[model samples]
Target: MPVGEWDAVLVGGGVMSATLAVLLAEVRPDWRIAVLERLDDAGQESSAGWNNAGTGHAGLCEFNYTPQRPDGTVDPAGAVRVAEQFAASLVFWGRLVERGVLGPPEAFVRSVPHVGLGQGTDGVAYLRARFEALRGHPLFADLEFSDDPGVLASWLPLVLAGRTDGEPVAATRAAQGTDVDYGVLTRRLLAALRERGGEVRLRTEVTSLRRRDGRWELAVRDRASGGRRRLRARWVFVGAGGGTLPLLQSARVPEVRRYGGFPISGRFLRTERPELVAAHRAKAYGSAAPGAPPISVPHLDLRVVDGRESLLFGPFAAFSPRFLTRGRRSDLARSVRLGNLPVLLASARDNRSLIAHLVRQVTAPPSTRMAALRRFVPTARDEDWTLVAAGQRVQVLKETGGRGTLVGFGTEVVTSAGGSLAGLLGASPGASTAVAAMLDVLAACFPAQADEWRPRLAGLVPPPTPEEVARARRVLGLAPVRPAVAP
Candidate 1:
């Protein structure tokens, strides 16, 4: 058996690992890095253009980030933080483009208006308040709101067409929002890594992980030949999406005991009709469904992949025992252990509404599903749109207060004691915030080098300083979002 050694072994070829590889290459070029993917190709799961909505999640349109306060005020802190992270990502991508590491921006990311929509008095009021709260923030400077039906028709003709106006509806638009092909971006990043002398192995799985002689050892199996090999790395990263938790557990990591994952599959209604696709060039995000979690928020988006335009809507949920889109059926039940059982059971008990929503979605009749699309596109035809499978997202369940609880909708970084190992958990705003997330991993996993790495990191990504943020907005051609003024 051949034994390979490296400075790092990144499990998974999705955006997270690819992004980390890019950053590491620029920061520590001499250190060898290898990315091992179980799938035959990179980004086959979560990061695929077809699998994700591809919104450049800068908090411009997502309502989940801003919550209403007691005084009826919308707190924009969460949104601001998310926006900041996205800004860093923009900076990273922009620099990569300039360096010829990535191809044309239009290939992977394109400017697409992002809008938040709501109807009824309660919903309208929330949208109105949210707009007011975010109006002058640096990150939301160019945000605009309109309650006029005539104006809405111009912005979202499909949504307003063939519908009579009764209850007032409102929307907020940010023309600087984007639709990104994370899969393409992932491939480009991997290309950049290879250009810099890094390695990526597809159709290769990391079968097991163990600590041996103060180093991490991974058992690798080639799907083609069924040949097994061993490899060692000074540091290891589990960015395998839903596959991360189980792999961490297999390594006997103590931190993995507190974490479990539940698979959530999404299906989208996609239309390639030129007319429909042309009518909507923006990503319109609506409020979460009744009794639904933030992750279940419905969105209607215009996606451009490989230069082809299309519209996608409705992330209808379904039940899948597999952790990944291609994982084994026994994945869900096999993940259970005494340490994580309480958390898993408690999460199941607490997330009854979520489970119920999934059940309703799976059992929904054709008419029922059509009605959903009608909410976003009043004149949507059953023939114009076809149901298509999106990606599988696994939400992380963590033990909190001795009970398992679903983590919030954003991403979380988990590092083992001594920082020898690290993994990313949770869903939503993931790929869009990969650079910022990887920065956190770098800081947590390599504290000794963080200070020295900070200056170099700034060159690779958007900085946190106000001046740098302003510069990033300019570099990325973003809507003016300077920072909100006190209302």
Candidate 2:
């Protein structure tokens, strides 16, 4: 077989590409690999710690993962699957630590409690059900739930402070939940991959992709020098966050030809106030406004970026034309094409409430956001928090049955059936599930080498044997649950 120009070329320096690059480095160390990033550096866009909530997203506190049914029954399948997938990521990170590929674990992940909290009759019922649904799962063995004010006060004093009303309130906690700085983690993984001799090209943008003799020829340009070049690779991956859709479209990949993006910009009320920040420790998640997207569910998160702890609340969703934080303002318009016109128009007609929620979020004054924050921190002072722009998330829209469908609230890996190209789209449960997501890409694209690669992957994210799962839990600082011995 003729050796291709390069073994693999990965676009985007964010979590997805970094993750796949690291995995491929371990699986195919001898293959030539390159990671090209459009930004001046990696981790500046959606991967930035401040740009996201930084929640580990293990379904520990994100109630949206477990939805209630029409008959008042709650489904735990989504929550359980998410927890299992996130555990795979923990296992991968733990192996990296044991192998000394990464520095101190705290540099990227920090243990913070994950709490699901609610008030009133409906809120209390939901929390109780959500807590019960997850209690039996080994992954959530350390979970706890309560309705007592004293119990809640200890777990979350800020939310309960100065509230004397006998209004019913309920909460659940998983002590081992984490806050992960994807920005830091992304840079760390890339560094390790670099140390292993993988090449990383920064400030280089891929303008187009063309297929030539079963390989991909990427048209690249150096943003600073205004120089253009072409790079050839056996395989190409578009993991450029919101930019993935356009690049996939440019590639003319039939798999992603009709896909479009609906850009959602998130803003948070952030506070570094010692008093306010110190009062909250857990990431508190609450229900979303009726008809709002699940990703917009309210949450007050404890974020640790660059070792400084702060609080972030209320992702007041708004509309934006740009797919990325630094992308051109005309990005949304550029994405509109004949292929996705009907689907785009259909989504508009079907999701009126979602569109309305976004509009209300944008028009709502600062005071309205402050009011939303007050739901989590009853005594939160407006003076204590500052409204700050977070990041851009472009949710994927696809045409199915000749109508547009909102695919999901999490990431989707789009790949060619033949396995030469792959792109990731959607948002939520994003970086926290990078390991599992990349594993999917590998399984899809590397079918030829999969039999050989499986054992290597198993070494890292081993089968969930009793001992194996416990080991991964221990690495995350979670207490290992011992199987009960017959008395």
Candidate 3:
């Protein structure tokens, strides 16, 4: 059993836990912090480069963020919020790089243009409205939109090749976009935490957590040795990705009683062919199908992982009983309880479209998936691409306004027990906004110290003003955002 209690204990070795660990270490250098991971190393789960799209999800290209309103206008609020959050992440990482905590930025993050494509007359009109809505914001001032085939071909040659349907298409491009290898970044952050006297225990699974005598007592098991031990901490953060819900339930947290988790796994079609990869230098996203979940929004991305570049497309949704990819097959069955049964049932009743969408995707054949990819890249050859399993995403289900709602890819921070324990739920725009999300956790969990910590936190992660955004981009080796041209 581990003896002295820790000031903070962060569960999960993904980017979320790594970011919070580093932030706590920076803000309170005297506090003892520890990170626990079931995996042999950090970021092997959702944070891994191959498990996710690797986009710096700044709302630059993802169309789902800017939904069209009933008035035939596009709402830019969500897009701006995501853009701001991503900018905060850039500032945090940029500062860390300058302090020599992280190595060269290009090793983990690289410049990749972001584009939003809209096909057909209605699609093009909606995209034009979206462009007009976001082009005036300081964050999106450099956004460019055009319906001309020549401009789109110049932007996405691979998508334009072999296309002859003559369907009208338009796209919006943001030059200052990025692709990040979060697995590398997570490892780097954890390494920095260790250098600052923080402890990281790998291959240690936290089996359960109990609140006793004003502190958290955790029972952890050693995967390799079959040894069990007990550890204590003043504060506990469950950033376990899909594994978060079960841990919170085990702790008997009343706040989680009404919550349920719906596990959705994904598959991506990837091609390492140099010619195809060379033709697509951007992460190009399109709208989701009518009955699909937000995670089904199709995108063709140029992914840079471990200094190698490849093109990936189609996050074809697959049904999974396990919350985490490596989790137990009975995880879903075990999670159901009398408390959340109603929530789960109601969610099912309310989200039949999403459920049906998952059914179709799970049964979809390889030929169908390839055909879906051809929507983005008309010239994509089946021989050049292979299907690879992506990370499992556990969408949150909870009652909102007297109805059970199945939340999409947006993330939520849930705190309980007078803020002593906190957990992160939901997915998408996850790692890219981790710094900001952790900052929120800090503020919520430690309201007393927030005022004092504000100055220090600000210094570490300043607000993303135009100047700060440019500075971070410069330090991160991303291209400068050119001024927006008149639409």
Candidate 2 lDDT, 23-124, residue by residue in tens = 998888898888999888999899998999998888988878899888766789888888888888888888887788877788888778889987889999
Q: Each candidate's lDDT (Cα)?
A: 0.86, 0.85, 0.92
Model 1 accuracy (lDDT, Cα): 0.86
What are the per-residue Cα lDDT tens digits for candidate 1 across 79-164?
A: 99898888788888877877878876677887899999987898889999999888867778768888888889998988888877
Model 3: worst 10 consecutive residues (lDDT sum): 1-10
Instruction: State candidate 1's TM-score.
Output: 0.96
User: Which structure among the candidates has the greatest TM-score?
Assistant: 3
**Which candidate's lDDT is highest?**
3
lDDT of 3 by residue, 1-487 (tens): 3565898999999999999999999889998899999989999999998999998999998888898999889999999999999999998998998888988889899889999999989999999999989999989988999988899999999999999999888999999889999999999999999999999999999999999999999999999898999889999999999999999999999989999998999899999999999899999999999988778999999998888899989899988899999999999998998999999999998999988898889998899999999888887788999999999999989999878898786889999999999999989778999998999999899999988888888888988888988898889888998888795
Displacement of residue 32 (Cα, Å) in model 2 is: 0.5
lDDT of 3 at 75: 96
